[model samples]
Target: MTKPFDVKIGINPISWSNDDLPSLGGKTPLSVALAEGKAIGYQGFELGNKFPREPEALRAVLAGHGLELVSGWYSGRLARRSVEEEIEAVDTHLTLLAFNGAKVMVYGEVADSIQGTQEPLYKRPRFFHPEQWRDYADKLNAFAQHTLSRGVRVAYHHHMGAYVETPADVDRLMSLTSESVGLLFDSGHMTFAGGDAVAVLARHVGRVCHMHCKDVRPRVIRHARNRNWSFLESVINGAFTVPGDGSIDFRALIRLLYDNDYSGWLVVEAEQDPVVAPSYRYAEKGYRYLRDLVERVPLEAAREAA
Candidate 1:
């Protein structure tokens, strides 16, 4: 039987968090993601991990717009001192997101100690010191058990500067972890870290409960290479852009997910300045391209049956 292709749409609030671009959006970050999602044809949004901690209020706001929380990218780190502590933190944060309709909390940060003082964290990353992977997985398992107990799913986001920053690390961590844990595949970040986004997406498709629709510029990547720059630097230097405006092929990527029986949110996460282009221009473009990608990207499997 073919899988359903009811692709979910979302926006990242980081762009809207900018003090500039007061035009095409709202005052707060959650407001911006919800409003933009509504205006640009998105079905819902993954309330960014940094949203206000109050679940009741956030849910109220999302419900008012006829919107749903596709998922929440929980940006909590799991590599703290103890597994017990990590599980405790997840227990608290997971409940907050669940009350607001979110099913996942992305393991979203590097070992905080290693981050140093880079504003925006645009460095090459020295996360090779993941001395806690096995123990971390045990902690994550405990968290997942608690979250799933609360009727929520926990997805781990392997980032560039974070512990699991590369293909080998992602493989080591995911391979070791039990099926209780899910993964949030970020295309742009994977590519930035010299990892194959498509390969990782395909390999971990089953474990993916949610995905980020961010892409990167090959030109900027090459520039970074020439400068011997860091992954975070590439992100800061516009090495990343909206999907269609970048090098990654979403058509093929979406088709893969559609084939894998994947049915979850596809968040349009643009972590860049909206001022460089026309106000909301890149976002508007990304919105259109992703919507079209969802509706128009030939799901041969879906199409043949349709």
Candidate 2:
């Protein structure tokens, strides 16, 4: 069946192997991950810890499965470093992304981040001073321009424990940076951080370049907040899940993107224990949910035309 919408579905390798904790899917090979993702009808994949670093090698491996490189996460420190320094940190990755034909680079701020730390989630990083934001935005503008020079756009990822965790933080960052810097809209992280996923997308759809379609288990989220769990701890405790298995209303979200002419990679990214969730099963679940949504779009269009 053909899809009505023009979005390509991709999967993050974190489902097959947890990069932060390693032990979750440590034994699973990259080959296995690619095979399973392709088998489930994913046309692309995001880079993870076990992915090949060299462009040619990565390209050959992905081509073997008829998949493409969607994007890769680049940990940014523009909040505390010079523009030159932040660019240097992601130069190699940017080169690889360009060589492999990726358009968006996931820029996540990790300056003093408590993402993987055992500390409480309440201690997650945040930038407070106006002067600090001015300096960071200036650096981000230069860095985005540098990446644009190489034909790749920067999509800032608002991660759970990073500097841009809340909806207000996203608003501030969008306000500070120029339109060249796009937003990597992630539904799961926004919900996990207590932000309205739909509201954020509605407000920033024009500035969104890439998207992450992950859902959350509401009870687990409540548990995490009540127990003062860290970001990684909440992930370990089953706070996130594939779209159909969680509480988020993805039908509405997908329709919103479709109506707004949003087109690009819609990646399914849920960092879970591979043993508990079973990578292949969850990947297939997410793929089916998205495919079904796309199939129904034509009907919705017909209704609108009527």
Candidate 3:
């Protein structure tokens, strides 16, 4: 049975190789990653540090594997730098995305992020004072305009250690920026940040242009809190995983998106050590989990109609 709307499935290479901590899967070649990803039934892929930076070269590699370059991460330092500086930092990445015919660019503000570090994760990320919020939001609006001009959309990623990690942070950002700036809703991060993923989705579904289907282990999360683990430490302690293998109810989440007419890429973005949880196996598992969610109810409806 077909879904009522188009929702392509994609995966990130971080499942295979941690870009921040290269030691995780640094030895895993790009060729192997592309091959395994295609074999696991992913329709698209996000760019990783191992991927070729040149648009044409990257396109050729993806073309051979029958995959699309859906989107890639662009670190924006808008919290401290000028909008022009932010734009300049992302210009090359935006150009590559534009040239590759990708429509969305995931913008993660990394100026004060502790995502890659082993620092204590119990404290809240840096809070944006009112004046700083104004500046940051203004810059994001301008950056959205620039991306829109290039036939791409900027999807602000609310990540765990980044400044905009919590639900309130997301609300503040949405309120400050123009409607042109879209959101990249990640369910796992929301759960990790101690927020209701379903409610957050409901509140900001209109602004969401892309999605990341990540799941978390409650026990590891509890342990992380108890042990004062860092973001990377939590990941190392087995806090994250693909949809069904962990605690997130992806079915309920997808049903919400389905009912609300949500469409576009649903990316599997669980960053884990490849050795403990093999990449291809987890990729296949995540793919099946999402495939079931999208098809489960719709197929039953189709059968009843028949």
Q: Which of 1 and 2 is the better model by TM-score?
A: 2
Query: Which candidate leads the pack in lDDT?
Result: 2
Best by TM-score: 2
User: Of the candidates numbered 1 and 3, which has the greater TM-score value?
Assistant: 3
* Off by more than 4 A, model 1: 1-3, 18-33, 113-116, 119-132, 225-232, 302-306
TM per candidate comes to 0.84, 0.97, 0.95
CA lDDT for candidate 3: 0.88
Once fitted onto the true fold, the runs of candidate 3 whose alpha carbons sit more than 4 angstroms away are 1-3, 300-306
lDDT of each: 0.69, 0.90, 0.88
Residues 83-198, model 2: lDDT tens digits: 87888888899999999999999998888999989888888877789988888888899999999999999999999888888899999989999988999999999998898889
Q: Which runs of model 2 end up more than 4 angstroms from their true locations?
A: 1-4
lDDT score, candidate 1, position 227: 79
**Lowest summed lDDT over 10 consecutive residues: which window, candidate 1?**
17-26
RMSD of each: 3.7, 1.7, 1.9
